[model samples]
Target: MKAAGFGYHRPETMAELLTLLADLPDARIIAGGQSLMPMMNFRVAMPQHLVDIEKIDGLDSINLRDGTLQIGAMVRQADALASPVIKKNCPVLADAIAYIGHQQTRNRGTVGGSLCHLDPASEIPLVCALLDAQLYIASRRGTRMMNFRDFADAPLTTSLAEDEILTRIDLPICDPDTRHGFGEYARRSGDFAVVAVATHLRFAGETITEARMAFAGLGAIQARADRLEMFATSQKLSPALIDKLAQEAAQMPAESDLHHDADYKRHLAACLLREVLERILRHG
Candidate 1:
């Protein structure tokens, strides 16, 4: 099926993009067009206009400023994966991007598009939630920052207003003591995960001072298992403790889709959680 008829506009400046968005409130903003194009091809989305933001200057750069990693909304997944600042400051994010589609798709998929699409199986949303990343949005009213948990509302839905555009992603730089790990289960390479988990730990000597765990493919939105995260901290890292937390994490709500049953997803969650935790403990 062909995409429904729509006017296409490529804006080279942020001001132009904002004007286009505000004037055409129903227009869809295209970054990499990775997710939107497919949806359009499937006739799932029929926007009257496509305001392409890729031509906008400075939206594709990755920079670190004032101890925060600022990623432009139009930054490609491949570029982000290869960013030295990202690799050093947030290895887990790099690892997560490595699992997104393949090299070609990663080269064209923008981080802002992925987060805005809000697919439950997407790695970016889960990582964003795990790291407490802030999304910067622009609208006629002005710019505003929203946390990942609040920005993403459900699969294929976000809190972004019709005239708003996602401009950047702000991630706090990881401290020296921070340890990160990521894991995912997919039927094939480059396919969306049946379940994905991202975890971070801050340790003082041998004790875990802080910890966070977020899971995708479990609910209407990517979610952090705060209950299990709190339990894992302060406890000595051991196979036994890892197994216990994994088991507890399995109790979290999981969505059942055509590909897998609820029980299987729950089992995968426990297994992957343990795997990630063990790896972090060994390396930390």
Candidate 2:
């Protein structure tokens, strides 16, 4: 169905967008609109005004500063996936984006849009949690940075005030010892994942120094598998240890949906986590 009556304004600059957002507190910020358009079509969101930021200049660049990679809010997913900086600094992010929708959707979807949209089954959130990415936000008051873990409140919900616009995402550069892997199970190539896992392992010589694991498509918010991570890090990086961690991760709380029951999702999570851990351990 066509979107209910709404007004649209395409801002040419960040300042202009901020002013418009301040004036129209309830207005929805549209960047790429890949996720928003579907919600609008389904009548899940009926904003009175849409502040389109696609034409706003300079919000589509990717830069490396100091030891962090900064990606502008409007950077397309396809561009991000092809970015050498992203590949070198945050390969897990590149891997996660590779699993997002199709080429067309990736061309039209923005990194900021995906993070702000906060779909529980999406890859962006899981990447954020795994990398401990930071989100930059701008409002009439000033700019503030939020940890990804705190920025996302629930599925499709964020802590962003209505007047705040996500400006960029800041990801730490991957250390030489850092090893990462991403895994997901979807019914089809372009479908949302039934269960997804992103794993980051830091190896010191041979023993596991650190392990960070995040999960999607199972909780209201993308979450870190803390118990699993702790267990995996405390043990040797072996197939048996990975299997035990996967079993523990599978026991974590999971939401049930019509497509899959909680028990089934738990099993999938365990299997995928083990697969991802094994791949990273073997390759790195």
Candidate 3:
């Protein structure tokens, strides 16, 4: 299907962009258009006005300040993946982005676009959730900062109002002591995962001090393995404990889908989590 006819406006400045959004109530912000374009092509999105922000300057830089990694709204996934700063500060993010899509898609996909799209199976939102990132939003009313968790509402849905524009994403610097791992059960190299696991383990001597786990492709929103994290924290990993964790993960509930049954996804989640946990523990 072809996209419905729409009016396009490319603003050269943030001030002009804000004025457009204020005037056009049904306007949609277009950055990389990797996600939105598809929706429009399928006729799922029929916005009458597209306010493109690509011509606007100052929304494409990466910076580090006060122990946080601040990425602009227009930063491409490919550019972010190759950034030395991202690699050094948050290897887990780089690791996850490698699984996103093909190189071409990454080259055109923007960080703000990915987060706003909020696909439950996407790697970007999973990383943002695990790292506790903040999203900076702007509107004619004013600017406000929101936590990523608060920004995500449901599958393919977010809390961003139609008139609000995502301006920046701020991710906390990964602690040097934090050992990270990411694993997913994808049918192919570039496909979305059937089950995804992301973890951060901090060790104090031989004991596990902090264990944070985030999972995707199991629900409407990326979920945290609260049961698993709570059980693993402050607990030394043993053969028996590992076995128990795997069993528990396999039994965790997930919604049934048309292709895979709930039980099958749960099983994959168990396998992926155990594999990543073991890998991170062995290496770190």
In terms of TM-score, which candidate is stronger, 1 or 3? 1
Question: Better model by lDDT, 2 or 3?
Answer: 2
lDDT of 2 by residue, 1-284 (tens): 77887999998988898999999856999898999998898889999999999888888999999899999989999999999989998999999999999999999999999999999999988999988999999988999999998899978999998889999999888899888899999999979999999988888886788889999988888989888888878567888898788779779899999889999999999889888888877876
Estimate, for each residue in 28-69, the C-alpha lDDT of model 3 and write its tens digit. 888889889989999899999998898999898999999999
Task: List the candidates' TM-scores in order.
Answer: 0.97, 0.97, 0.96
Residue pairs that clash (backbone atoms under 3 angstroms), model 2: none
For model 1, residues 1-284, the per-residue Cα lDDT tens digits are 78999999998878888888889857998888888889999999999999988778888889989999999988999999999989998788899999999988889999888999889999998889998999999987899999988898778889998989888999988888888889999999999999999998888887888888999888878888989988978977788889889889878888799989888898999999899888877876
Give the range of the ten consecutive residues with the poorest summed lDDT in model 1: 17-26
Cα lDDT of model 1 overall?
0.89
Clashes of 1: 0
> Candidate 3: where is the Cα deviation over 4 Å?
none
The local distance difference test score of each candidate is: 0.89, 0.90, 0.87
* lDDT value, residue 61 of candidate 1: 86
Question: In angstroms, how far off is 33's CA in candidate 3?
Answer: 1.1
Q: After superposition, how far is residue 8 of candidate 3 from its true place, in Å?
A: 0.3
What ranking emerges by lDDT with the best candidate at the front? 2, 1, 3
RMSD of each: 1.0, 1.1, 1.3
Q: How high is the lDDT of residue 103 in model 1? A: 89
Point out the higher-scoring one by lDDT: 1 or 2.
Answer: 2
